[model samples]
Target: MFNDISGKYDFLNHLLSFGIDKIWRNKLLGSITFASDSKVLDMATGTADVALQIAKEKGVEVTGADISDGMLDVGRVKVKTKKLEDLVQLVNGDAENIPYEKETFDIATVAFGVRNFQDLPQGLIELHRVLKADGQLRVLEFSKPKSSFVFWFFGLYFNRILPFVGKLVSKNNTAYRYLPVSVNAFPEGQDFCDYLRNAGFTEISFKPLTFGISTLYICKK
Candidate 1:
C-alpha cells in the first residue's frame, strides 16, 4: 500500500497537513536529548526524513527502517543527494520484529508510524529491547481533537475532503482513506501510555499538538 504511493507521499503529507507535519516533526526532534555518541534508530522511517535531519544536525549514526522499498529507495537518493551516506542508512525492517540485538541503540523515533503497527505492543517491546538503559524513544502520531469545534471541522476534513483531495493528487484510492480510519481506531492518551508501560517504558508521557490533532509520546527505558 505504501509502495504504491511512495512517489507522492511526501508531497501529499505536507499538503494535507498544511505543512504542520513538519512542525510536528520538529517538535519530535526537539523532544530528543541527544548523547554525543547517540546511535539512533528510526522505525517505519518512510523517506528517512527524521534520520537525515538528525544526522545533519548532530552528525550521528542513524539507521532508518521501513518495509517499503519504494520509500527506502527515495530516502537513499536523498541521503546521497545530501552527501549523508556516512551518517544515515536506510534498511528494510519490521517494527514488530526488529533486526537488531538487545540494547543496541541510544535513541529511537517513530513519526506517524506506531498506529500502523500490526502488533502495537510487540512493536513497542521491540523498541524497548533495542534501546540502551536510559535510552529515550519518541513517537509522533495522529489523534482525536480535543476541542468541539476543531473536532467537528477536522472530522469533516479528515473523513471527506482530505481523502478526496489525496486521491486526486496521489492517484491512489485506498491509502489516504485508510489513514483516518487507522488513526480513529488506534488507542490514544493514557490508554496508549498503558501500552508503553507494559513494554517496560518509564516516565511515559504525551502532549497533544495542533489542537489535539496529533500527539507526541516521550518515553525512556
Candidate 2:
C-alpha cells in the first residue's frame, strides 16, 4: 500500500496539511536537545524530510531507513541536490528490524510513521535497542484533539476534506483513506507514553502540537 503511493506521498502530504507538516517537522527537530556530533537514525523516513532537517539544523549525521525503495529514491535525489550526501544517508530497512547493531545511535526519530508498523511494540523495542544509554527517542504522530468542538471540526476535515484533496492530487484513494483510519486506530496521550515506558524508556513525555492535531513523544533510554 505504501509502496504504491510512494511517488506522490511527499507532494500530497504537504498539500493536504497546508504546509503545516513542514512546520510540525521543524518543531519536532527543535524539540530535540541533542549535542553536537550526535548520531541519529530516522526510521520509516519517507523522503528524508525530518532526517534532512535534523542534519541541516543540528549538524547531526543522519541515517534514514525505510522499507520502500521508491521513497528512498526520492530521498537520495534530495540528499544529492542539497549537497548533504556526506551528512545524510538513506538505506532500505524495516523499522521493526533496524539494520544497525544495538546501542548504535545517540537518538532515534520517526515522524508520522509509527502507526504504519505491522507490530508497533516490536518496532518500539527495536528503536529502544538501537539507542545508546540515556539516548532519546522522538516520535511525531497525529492525534485527535481533546476539545470536543475542535475534534468535530478536525474529524470533518481529516475524514472528508483532506482525503478528497489527497485523492484529487495523488489519485490514490485507499492511501488517503488509510491515513485517517491509521491515526484513529493508534493510541494517544498517556496510553502511548505508557507503551514507551513499558519498552524500557524513562523520562517519557509528550507534547500536543497544533491544538492536539499532532503529538510529539520524547523518551530516554
Candidate 3:
C-alpha cells in the first residue's frame, strides 16, 4: 500500500497538513533526550524523515528500517543528498520483527507508523526488545480530535477533503482512503498506553498535538 504512493508520500503529508506536519515532527524531535553516542532506531521508517532529523543532531547513529523499498529508495536519495551517509543507514525490516539485536538501541521512534502495524502490541514488543535498559521510545500518530468544533471540522477534512486531495495528487485510490479507516479503527490514548505497558514499557504517557489531530506517546523500558 505504502509502496504504491511512496513518491508522493512526503509531498502529500506536508500538503495535507498545510505544512504543520513538519512542525509536529520537530516537536517530537525536541522532546527526545539522549546522549550524543546513543544509537537510535526508527521503526516503520517510511521515507526516513525521522531518521534524517536524528542524524542532524550530530554524534548519534541512526538506523531507519522499513518494509517498503520504494519509500526507502527515496529516503536513500535524500540521505545521500544531505551527506549523512556516515550517521544514517536505511534497512529493509519489519515492525513486528526488527532486524537488530536485543538491547542495541538507546532510543527508538515511530512517526505515524504504529497504526500500520499488523500486530500493534507485537510491534511495540519488538521495539522494546531492541532498546537497551531504560531506553526511551516515542510514537507520533494520528488521533481523533477532542474538542467539539475541532472534531467536527477535522473530521470533514480528514474523512473527506484530505483523502480526495490525496487521491488526486498521489493517484492511488485505496491508500488515502485506507489511512482514515485505519486510524479510526486503531486504539488511541489510554488504550495505546496499555499496549505499551503490555509490551514491557514503564512511565508511559502521551500528549495530543495540534488540537488532538495527532498524539505523541513517550515511554521507557
For every model shown, what is its TM-score relative to the native structure?
A: 0.99, 0.97, 0.98
RMSD per candidate (Å) reads 0.7, 1.0, 0.8
How does candidate 3 fare on TM-score?
A: 0.98
Across 1-221, the per-residue lDDT of candidate 1 in tens digits comes to 89999999889988999999989989999999987799999999999999999999988999999999999998999999999999999999999999999999999999989999999999999999999999999999899998999999999999999999999998999998999999999999989999999999999999999999999999999
Off by over 4 Å in 1: none
Local distance difference test values of all predictions, in order? 0.95, 0.91, 0.93
Which candidate do you rate higher for lDDT, 1 or 2?
Answer: 1
Candidate 2 deviant stretches above 4 angstroms = none
Candidate 1, poorest ten consecutive residues by summed lDDT: 28-37
Better of 2 and 3 by lDDT: 3
lDDT per residue as tens, model 2, 1-221 = 67778788888888788899988898788778888879999999999998898888888899999999989998999999999988999999998999999999999999988989999899999999999999989999999999999999999999999888878877876888889999999998899998898889999999999989999998899
Q: Candidate 2 at residue 169, lDDT?
A: 77
lDDT of 3 by residue, 1-221 (tens): 88999999999988889998888888888888979799999998899999998898646899999999999999999999999999999999999988888999999999999999999988999999999999999999999999999999988998999889999999999898998899899899999999999999999999999999999999999
lDDT-based ranking, best first? 1, 3, 2
Best by lDDT: 1
Q: After superposition, how far is residue 61 of candidate 2 from its true place, in Å?
A: 0.7
